[model samples]
Target: MLDDTLKTQLKSYLERVTQPFEIVASLNDSESAREMQTLLQDIAAMSDMITLKTDGQDARKPSFSLQRTGTEMSLRFAAIPLGHEFTSLVLALLWVGGHPPKVEPEVIEQIQSLDGDYNFEVYMSLSCHNCPDVVQALSLMAVNNPRVRTVIIDGALYQDEVNAREIMAVPTVYLNGAEFGAGRMNVEEIVAKLDTGAAARDAVKLSAKAPYEVLIVGGGPAGAAAAVYAARKGIRTGVAAERFGGQVNDTLAIENYISVLETDGPKFAAALEAHVKAYDVDIMNLQRADQLVPATHEGGLIEVKLANGGVLKSKTVILSTGARWRNVNVPGEQEYKNKGVAYCPHCDGPLFKGKRVAVIGGGNSGVEAAIDLAGIVAHVTLLEFGDALRADAVLVNKLRSLPNVEIHTSAQTTELTGADGKLNGLNYVDRVSNEAHRIELEGVFVQIGLVPNTEWLKGVVELSKHGEIIVDARGQTSVPGVFAAGDVTTVPFKQIVIAAGDGAKAALGAFDHLMRMPA
Candidate 1:
């Protein structure tokens, strides 16, 4: 805990930094023992402030404080700032310094009507750039409605808390004692949740439902392309997506995708979505389709049931649901995802340009990212849990020939280490020698493989042994009026151009099928 004199100094420093035109008062305790309590109270009084109290076994109670006054803010971390936590503190201070603009009055009133103290805490890692928008939206509700207090916790800083909550991804928001929302959330949806009294049961019953002619599931490059092509063909197409851009949106860049020389994932996704919207496509964001039931007495009609209980019926269905990256499931892997660990090499590799990067897995994607990064990054440490690289001979040769690339055969990642909130490096154990060595790296990319997004399909469609949707040459699935394309299907390459072409083929197949049906 901070002493009275130190607390006063902190307050003074904050005031000086923020330069709040409004008169600021510093409340300090005369006694050293009472200082910590006073500081906590002072922080609680501020409009937007966070006070972190740390009581580790070895060290004295360290109280880190941050406060915002107008345009400026001050950060004080009592613990020895190291690893991801240090980076988290810097970002927290930056967030305080740039307080979001006041929300609209109607929105404020809607949030304020809720009775009782509702505490919403969102746990996220800094690597998720999409999370800040959600945090800002929640903060607006907190500022307007005093009863609703929203806290954004850096997942890395609160690893134990994240583990207790069983957080599997970034940008997971918890309302009160239960999970409220995850990923990115718009302001309107959040306001609706708060207005419903924070009752998950009640909230679930109040969402809206709609039907579509052509319901496209997934939001990856393939899905987006399908939506665009279908909409342009004068078909009433609607996209039901868990996320706007799926796996492609999480990428750093797509240089191999022709025409676009080099582009980031989020930016490319935004462009793709915008292009789809330019037509008449209805994009239902953040909606996950859980089940697909064949419509009774229908000419190739399907009813898609969403996880949110909303039902969408369509004459045709296009499943472009892409795959998810596989993880090692080792200790600290989940805690360090997006902190020092990442899944997409193209997305995060540039961030470590001219620095060392570790690529996990012996597969094609792992070897490819490693070879790609070797050209730009200073050094590439490729760790393959197996004795040999599982990629194609050409890729393996390319990787081996790179001067900066080091292949670690039969090496397993044991631990991830970092200082502040950024990745510092990782430790690996050699299976052959049973010896361990740590390498300093700016990033680690996990490219073991991908699990197809076909779990929900179950009995709805025919899938290959690898779980990939089995589709005909014309992009038609076993089920009539339902088509599968891109990486989700058993197609050859997982490139963006191939996905786009697959999307086009699916749309044409659906159009031909729709034309043959009687009115």
Candidate 2:
């Protein structure tokens, strides 16, 4: 099933496999089963240490398991692991065949030491960029600990299973028949969830760390850039992030990140992390800062308190906590999230295929979502609070040209209506006519905009009316030795390139401030 170039690459990757492994597929007479068999054959043909067997009796047809020879270590895929999941399949093969993963030693040890039986089933879409992370993470755990078993299922291929579980989101994970999580999660995050004592241990370790010269309170593009710049200055630097990549992880196509022609969010975010890691920056992932405590005396350390009871102190702090999706805050919006209301069109769009859906907002994101969904869904109803669309002319034109898209300007979403834990429709009002309206749909995609992640700093820092941190030209905030940048700051445009530049400027500003301080 793979092209010649892909075959060559797969062969090269499989050469790293040191131990014997086998692909045991459970097949049927369906075309997908044949395709899966071809894929397995191509993969098995790459390495002499790898073997293929089609005699397995799995309940799910077109499914396969990568099993290490003479061991219970195995990972299963219930669908063709192509598209975004192809890399996940390759990683599973290598890891299952005794090829070491590029994870930290401590993380590997933690995975190995996990005591409980973890039967993880992940429902993911092939188009979802975030799915691979979850699949790979669980695959890593499964490869390390025999007690942990991960089964990756393609949601599009297994629509019956998805519907039965009422799964409306990609990368929805179920642990032992219960909903575990329903979004992008990394290995550390998953481990923390499984290991109850991990938070206290992490908090203790974080609190004991020495104060840094520059401490970045985010891990998006801004925080990464700041870390690189600070580390280049040969000063102590640390980064604390709720989740590395921030809002960018939910982003799909990023065509305007200069020099690079085109790339997705996950790849770009991974690159950012790798670049920051190349330096001596101490990165604390899955760490959410809840409060900022400024120094009482000049040249004193600024303290950033984490939600996990961890406190990190620094001489100069850069606030780049980034932003999150702005919810409509209407009734049932939160309650129906993942039930039918989704924020990411790219991730959840497939789940609504052949079903009527609504897009909230008339900006570029909303219009783009409508345009994209028109092809996959039965119909897209776009509601805008303004009289006119705020999207680019090209996007507006494209959206208008689509037959399946319906646009409603001056429409305010008042409530999302649903029953039995599933959304059925949404209620809106027309400002022009003052008439209330309701549209029946299976899914609602909120694409209004982002809200800065500055709620924690509401009373701590000087904020704009919109809750963004007020910063000067040098990315310096109102407080002395405290700088802010990225989406969390009062930056005009919240672009990746802009955020990175702001971060660098903030890092330089912090360095200059530190130079003038008394030792």
Candidate 3:
């Protein structure tokens, strides 16, 4: 399915291969096997060093294993690698054949210490950008350990299995038959679970007793920044975040975050966590706060109740719970989700390197995505349901300057079409002409809006009609001793730089609030 341009790119990647590599493809005379066989053959043709091995090990379940020129690495994918995951397939081939992944030695020790065989079932979609990191991490660990077995299942291809498990999101990890983890998690997180004997997620907790002087909620840039600032003050500070890095974890290409010229979501998230760990802040990771226990007395303490039967007490609290991506809930969108429908352009753009793609909601984010994808993909079609784009003049101008970009305002997307568990095209309606249109594209990126993660604080604190916490210039909310920052507040803009500044302001406000209390 690779075009001439994509072939050229793959050829360049294969040029770096020095050792011989072999692909042991186990498939039956099925349609998926036929498609996978052709795809793997094409990949082998790109490099004289790569060879394909076909045999019927288990025709019921498709499996592909990659080994060194003459040696076996024991790394394999039990399914076809298509859509956005094509990049991951290529990377894994290169890593196993040429350069081995450079994982931390401490991590290697943890993996070596792990006993007993654990089978991991990771649910993913083709267009899911974040799934590859976790998948690759598990593959690397499996290559290092004999007992760490993994099965990568495409959610769209196996909808029945997904429905049976009640799986609603991508990157959902299942250890054995029960759900283990959801959303984005790295290697250290999985290793942490192994260390604690925690079979599933949600059993992990922080200190339930002892009230901290300052408590920060949320784990995005704003919350992380606040915790760093507060912890630097040499006071008892703790941050209770559902997931550290907030919306920043799902975002891509943060070029406007001050000195950094360019960076992706996962890289920036790791840096944020590393920066926070350098201090003495008690980071309560993986704990979702359900309700806030308000203090009645002047010197009484407040409690932060969590969903996992854990509670935290504090004298002051800062809310930095960030936002989530706005999804386009259309037909076949949920079905083909990672197959060809995607949310983050930066993470999955490379998968559609030489393929045609579309961007929905031609606002600032849509325009930005078009600009980003245009540089990588063959063409970009941007759709907007409004009369005109609501973006900065510079962004629109840059988008227009792109040669492979087409913008269509007043265009309402009707449905996403797919076949063979992958997306192939999309349908839209022209508002002005009142006519329907269809376009053949490999991927679709939804970049419309941001939904704040503030539903858990509804009745506890004063919130705006849109559910964002109303805060003043000092980042103080309606409730005393409580502050909010970042996208979760009624801030003017949701930029990373703005959120980081607001976090610092909220930290200062919380510190000031605590100093006035009895010591």
Candidate 4:
């Protein structure tokens, strides 16, 4: 029998180790087993860093074996792996092995070159299956490089941390101190920022005193288009954005946009940014607009305040601020989001081919999701708590025509169910009938309406009841010298082509305002 002194010493040693470890019990006697179980439970309760398992069938075993690796450490349990527990055994082996298969060697080198200690934490829910590849890639990078440490924090497990970080979506990677990258990024692209130390810098630098003909906020389709048009017109233009692509980076495909029959959002945004960069347009990234006020000199110039405590003077301002997705405030919704529950149908639809899925919300996004998923998934159940869909006639017709789509009006989701630590189905109730039903689905896509990203512009510009900026045909806001465009503005459609065209109009309007300025 193991003495209390020996158990106490083992517990003390285990507590000091930072590496991930699994505990395996092999004691034969009932008293010894109880003590070992208690010790394991105490350790697990202390931190999420440790895993525990018990093995009590073998009485002949006198000793246990322990193996250590880079990622996981394993201890042999005197029991057979069977039934549901067999998977756990496999997981223990995999965890202890530390090696998670193989990835591209170039990807490894790219991650290894990154200087300084980087705690790259990716917040993801278990439901987002597609996110695993991205997480795995990041994990592989961490394995290859000592300076970089990758961790996948369950969004549900750490609610307070998620709230503090303002994580709205899954697969959100926080680098070092601030929010670094979002969505899925390839290894090469991630390395590019590290290689140049551009992303690692404090912030994008801009000349404080230099006067510009036009200053554009945001860098999505609208903002990028405005920058290109203004630069071509020989106007000294500058664009400041938190991120270059804005909301367009979240998009998966662009079939409706003109001149581009088929294109990915990132690729399109990259091309637009490149075209603008080819000219003399100055692009400042990772800069947030704090405020806008009248300039000292009259004639339509404005003073733009930045989050970095910097100021810029501009002849005119074009606000191409876009819209953000509405979130489902359900339990485990945030945790499993990006895992099985997603916001953008276009971004994640193709990934769930021949899978059973459900779409929440009855608005335009809801109808769009139903139509999109009907073509891809084996079956799609559109759940709307409203009486009817609020989409345009064209979209409504498309959604109704899909045979694989099933519309459930006045339906509300109560809970999400999962198995094997992954999303499996959902429990929903009918609003009118008060009847509840369980659905077995591989994915749940939230198609709720978008919220305009105009909270920052409150009191600065005239906004509609829905918070959309009120802009004229030329993308000129009610306030002279201040222009708005894209979905954030009073645009009829939130299409890429429409946003691009509106951006052009906003830039032209700014240029006109600039030309009339007093020299």
Candidate 5:
């Protein structure tokens, strides 16, 4: 049964349609095919414009095709359209109804100039805001040229493809049977890759001339705050990050940022980028800093080597590179990821509502997830690798107070078990008893400790035993002209507000150092 909330939204989306299209659904006798067929029928029945036509004569598997009422432009869908993909299916149907995407003239000309037939397959999730932009851009290319065809696949729906391509992220593109990069990308960048190949994507090189006074090496809240503060001082500033949003892009909800009631990761990240861009901060996104070359002489600029073959020089550098989630690399973990295995409880917990789920690792994050899931899920199981829980006593008491909560200490997760292309259960073992156990659950949240992204800075900067860069009170690193901030630094708490404050302090410290320099 479909959730009433989703049903209401789907109906509302279908009602606002400006045109009509036909949805030709075909099915086989297989179980998966039948299930997919039923899902399509249920959706098609919602609107008069949506038509379901079953073709058993030529049907090989559970598949459906979408074509305009009078046009030959048809797109094929070979999986069940559910979860975050529901949005993608909704948008695709609207586009089939004569709603052409807007495109730039230069992009159109580039697409029109292509000679050979090319099919651009974009793997995406409905929850990903970045996916819509790439999908729309490629859809424009496919519509503008007859030789080009683009298809957007929900990465969660096609489990086999996800396992085959090793797709760990959303909005991953596969060009002509080759794996392209992941992350949010612009239309011009995609076209550049398509026209001249991967080499063309890295054609824009960073210049070392006219070094900025302050350069922030991250794109999260910390880097954004730093850039804003530096730019406000009327000093040249630059922001370089592997991705503009950093770990904030992976988060779902934020309620404790001060003054903000509620906001999601993508929304907050967009606002941060917009705020930084409001100033004269030079944004060099999609660039990873590989090595940092400290300035040798006074007033001389430091050079930052990039992973994609470029060098950016700045008078002072602020390192705010954020931390990434430590994934539990057990069997079926990657295969069932985004299927039943998830890392961020905030981002994906709502998807598993009313279902039983488990939390791995007995840290503060696991206890918090158990408490949060207990309210939405049918049951919650907390598993810990240690003999005793590492969470605070208050959290332990609160968690024990929950009626549906269960805790297993010294439990080591062995494998994630799944069937029918979805996770169904989990297998683990007890360290003390030397016994094995299995639990029927739909979701697993890995909440192990976060690992700092400071391996690249080893030997270049002084680091703690855990690979975190050691920073003083003023955010100054062992290297004089370099500074560190955010989770990447020696900060105790890894909060958005804390990172923002650290970034601001780093920027001010850089400016202060610049002021004492002999001009």
Candidate 6:
């Protein structure tokens, strides 16, 4: 199961282990068990500090635990952590073996200071790009705090448990057998959820901070670029984001990003964060801005209010709060969300393996989702409200070649139908014929475009008909000293490169505005 290239990488990473650790595997007599044994043996052979033990009595086969020598610090994996989660597995090993993590000292302290025991069980899929963040977070907490325990379960491998818990989403987390959260979450976000007083404390600290010369909201490609450009100008730059990466976190593949041949969303997001961190930009993650207030006077500071009762004042503000996946908003869509209706095919496609599903929309994302689902699902029914597919010719041709896929143009999704707390089918209408129809399916993937994250800015700035912030060529909004960029703005293309360029333009525009202000 271990390839030569992977073995070399694993060996190099294991060299950072300062403490001896043992891999205790609980595997039964099965094909997967043999594969697991081989993988563990390959790992143990790389370092003398590592030992393999098969004495684990865990009921979950093909499961393993990494335990530090002469200590109780440990974490478990009930599935083979490969694909996107392979990095998570390596990080857990390094962390458990005494290699220091790359996190802020304060964050480490917070995790170690947690009061209660947290036994976290996270169900994930190998194809899910979002699962690694959550798995790595809980694993880091477990490695840091002996009171905390984490078990990363592969939903595909543990189908019985997944069905029993009615889990229909990837990276579905459970704490003490109760559902905690489902989706991409970092360590800081997890800590904030557990520590009841952390928000209030954070709010007080944030409110006391000095005003910034350039403050960027949201942490997608646009926000990151703006932060870099502003910090380069020797100005006080700050970024307050609900979560860094925004919609980019949900993206699976990116072959169009300039300068780079190919890369995934998480990798790109990480690089963006690292680049911004290299500058003087002060990044505040897990911070949500609910309101934006313009400056009253010519030189007054603009006030941005946070959801945690914290208000940040800035000399100039850059709004880059990127867009989110547009929902169908049809009946039963919300009620069956995660139960049958999912927006992210990359993360949730495996849940419907061998089951019939429908892909709503006929754009690039929708067509790509249908193609991706065709490989895993039994049958894919694609519905497009338009007369023809809006995807590129290449993608449309590829999708048409799939034998298990069917396309229906001029089809508008009317409602999602389900039974027993699960999605069972969906209703649609033939726009050209003015006739309604229904199709039976276990899952529905909504691939509609994006809705700008400018709802909070409503009544605050001039917006386009689609709710996008109207900006000039220099990226200045109607409100002076307030600039917008990326998907939230009136930019034509929502590509990453376009967003980055617009972000830089907005930063320069803000700087120009600052230069003209009275001292």
> Any residue pairs clashing in model 4, and if so which?
125-335, 127-339, 127-340, 128-338, 128-339, 128-340
Better of 1 and 2 by TM-score: 2
Q: What is the per-residue lDDT of model 4 for residues 1-519, given as tens digits with 9 covering 90 to 100?
A: 235664465455445444565554555555534554664566455435566555634332322223343433213332232222233233333433353433356456567677777767766544443244355555555555666665555554455666566554565777876777767664555665667753333333453458788889999889988999889899889998877777777665678876779976656776877888899988876677878786555675687777666777788889987888877677668667656777766545655667899999888768877887788689999888888877899998888888888888888888877755456788888899999998998788887867888887889889999999999878888777888878899888788888989999998888887777778
lDDT of 3 by residue, 1-519 (tens): 777887898889888877787888888767877878888888899888888988737433467877775553566676687765777777777766675566678677788788877778887777676787778777766666767776677766666676566554577787767778866777767887777753233343454357898898888899989989999899898987767787777865678889999997767887998899899988877667888877887667887888766778888889888888877778889887767787877656655667899999878888988999999899999999999988899999999999999999999899999877778899999999999999999889999898888888888888888888999998999878889999988998889899989999999998888888877
**Better candidate by TM-score, 4 or 5:** 5
lDDT of 1 by residue, 1-519 (tens): 445664565454344233222212222332422454444455433423344332322222333334444432222332222222333333343345443343456555676676677777776555555555566566655545556666666655455676566554567777877888776575657875565543343225323434566788887888888888888888789888877777776665588888789986767877888888789988776677888887665485688877767677888898998888878777667666766577756434544557788899888888998988897689999999999999999999999899999999999898877665566778889999999999987778888977888999988889999999999987889887889788899998787789888988888887787888768
TM-score of each: 0.61, 0.99, 0.69, 0.60, 0.70, 0.99
Query: Which runs in model 1 stand beyond 4 Å of their true positions?
Result: 1-211, 297-300, 329-359, 363-381, 385-406, 410-445
Backbone atom clashes (below 3 Å) for every candidate: 10, 0, 4, 6, 0, 0
**lDDT score of residue 28 within candidate 6:** 94
Q: For model 2, what is the error of residue 381's alpha carbon versus the real structure, in angstroms, after optimal superposition? A: 0.5
Give the CA lDDT, 0 to 100, for residue 148 in model 4.
Answer: 66
Cα deviation in Å at residue 455, candidate 5? 1.4
lDDT of 6 by residue, 239-348 (tens): 99988887888888889998899999999999999999999988999999999999999999999999999999999999999899899888998899889889889999
Off by over 4 Å in 4: 1-182, 185-204, 207-209, 328-336, 345-356, 362-379, 389-405, 412-431, 434-443
The pairs that clash in candidate 1 are 82-420, 83-418, 83-419, 83-420, 84-420, 84-421, 85-420, 86-420, 87-421, 252-347
Number of clashing pairs, model 5? 0
Q: What is candidate 6's CA lDDT for residue 216?
A: 97
lDDT of each: 0.68, 0.93, 0.80, 0.69, 0.78, 0.93
- Stretches of candidate 6 off by over 4 Å are none
TM-score, candidate number 1: 0.61
